[model samples]
Target: MVERMKTYKAIKYTLFVCCYLFWVASAVLIAVGVYAKIAKEGDVVDSLTADPALLLISTGSLMFIITFFGCFGALRNGVPLLKLFLGILVAILLMQIAAAVLGFLFSDLVLERTEQLMAKGIARYREDLDLENLIDFVQKKFQCCGVHTYKDWSGNVYFKCSETNPSLEGCGVPFSCCIQWKNESVLNTMCGYETQTLEERIAKDSIHTTGCLDKIVRWGKRNLILVGGMTVGLLGLEIFMICLAAAQISRIRGKVKTVNSRRRAR
Candidate 1:
């Protein structure tokens, strides 16, 4: 069986470049994770995962440092350790995939949490928006929180009765309740607020307040800027790796040529 040739210098250098980037990214992620765990820690593990930024940093680090470096032996000339290199690469990819899935699951959890916050926010806004008076009027007349009796008074406010529609008088306010009350229908307690109803308003506020994940991205970006600045260092390492590969290839080729020449002379 023909033996696979050793890795060429060009390929080794390319890999070196890739690996250095990985190491840097990994260091940042692990650092951030540690910092959070130490400094702020459990304060953001859940949301950070949801934003997926930290995961990216972690995964990126693994891809470059672990997988690329692990496969470095394959750069040898005249007998490629292709299998070993490939195995390491595959393992790292699997890790990345797992991280991605976990991140997505976390995002879903955040979304659910945001929804709960929305409910709470809407309830809170009710008092501030003077929605209780509206509710009282509706309860006294229609016994619901909807607009089934009155008409649009001004802007988003409504004055109506609950005699026509009894269903929306209670806890049946849709987030999209924009119907103009015309007859003896119930008046919605928190329906009219410019563009947002009670539900929408509350949902937005809750998510913004509770589920907003800007901090994660901001931190990630700041770290990435370091990564960006280190591009010069990374580039230099890549050049060195290429030079190392070229020298190795040259050394091996000279040996092979010498062996061939001796055989021909004999």
Candidate 2:
């Protein structure tokens, strides 16, 4: 009985610690997300499809609620709450597996959808500061320009190549597409100016002519092992948590049975 009690306490405390850590992480995410939302409130664009703050908040909120149940259920030995938490975790695991399978089987569809989203982002490039920064980061990191080609920036109103366009940035890609000079002390933000109007061979000397999608695909292939390892690690942790909760539930039920039998004997 003493050994059983020790094991029960060990599992209960371990589960509580895990849940508490996750709860704190969720709170941090929520706070950062809220701050971002407030900072960008004045320049609110149609960011429903690509807003980083919304994504952070939604993910953090879900995690916060789920971990709350896990923490309280473990600390109080509440069977119903533990069962609810276990059920949600199992459901989330199944959804993740299903998403992975679907992504693999419909890779072409996924790529097409990704391309469409990238194009939308490009069109709204200047409308959202956060999105603009994100695009610039991707372009600089990948050493690539537009979604499919440098010319794709023509879809954006500010960068469109037209005789009547009054925007000074007209017919030019963002500075991110420019090739960085060796030991350059200052950035030439106008380096991409009129590059879109130049011949491809000539423009290649000034800015990256390759598209971002291809670059990203190659990058993903190169880091497949790292990405796969992280995915597996996350799934494994969820499975372990589920098992721990189940074990604690069983221990609690056994203790209750022991108490009932002792009362009957007395």
Candidate 1 Cα deviation (angstroms), residue 147: 28
In model 1, where do residues sit more than 4 Å from their true spots? Answer: 1-7, 41-65, 71-82, 91-266
Give per-residue CA lDDT, model 2, range 1-266, as digits (tens): 78998999999999999999999999999998788888884555646577777777888999999999999999999999999999999999999999999999999999999999899989988877778888999999999999988999999999999999999999999999999989988989999998899988999999999999989998889999988999999999999999999999999999999999999999
Q: Write the per-residue lDDT of candidate 1 for residues 1-266, one digit (tens) a residue.
A: 12323544455556555555556767777676455444431333233323234444466555555544434543444323334444455554466557657756797775566545433323432322223333333233422222221121111212212334343333233222334345728655355332222344453331111111233334446798775567557555544544454454555566688789999999
What local distance difference test score does each model get?
0.42, 0.92
Model 1 — TM-score against the truth? 0.32
Report the number of the highest-lDDT candidate: 2
Candidate 2 ranges beyond 4 A from true positions? 41-43
Question: In TM-score terms, which candidate is top?
Answer: 2
Record all residue pairs in model 2 with backbone atoms less than 3 Å apart, i.e. clashing: none
TM-score, every prediction: 0.32, 0.94
Query: Among all windows of ten consecutive residues in candidate 2, which has the lowest summed lDDT?
Result: 41-50
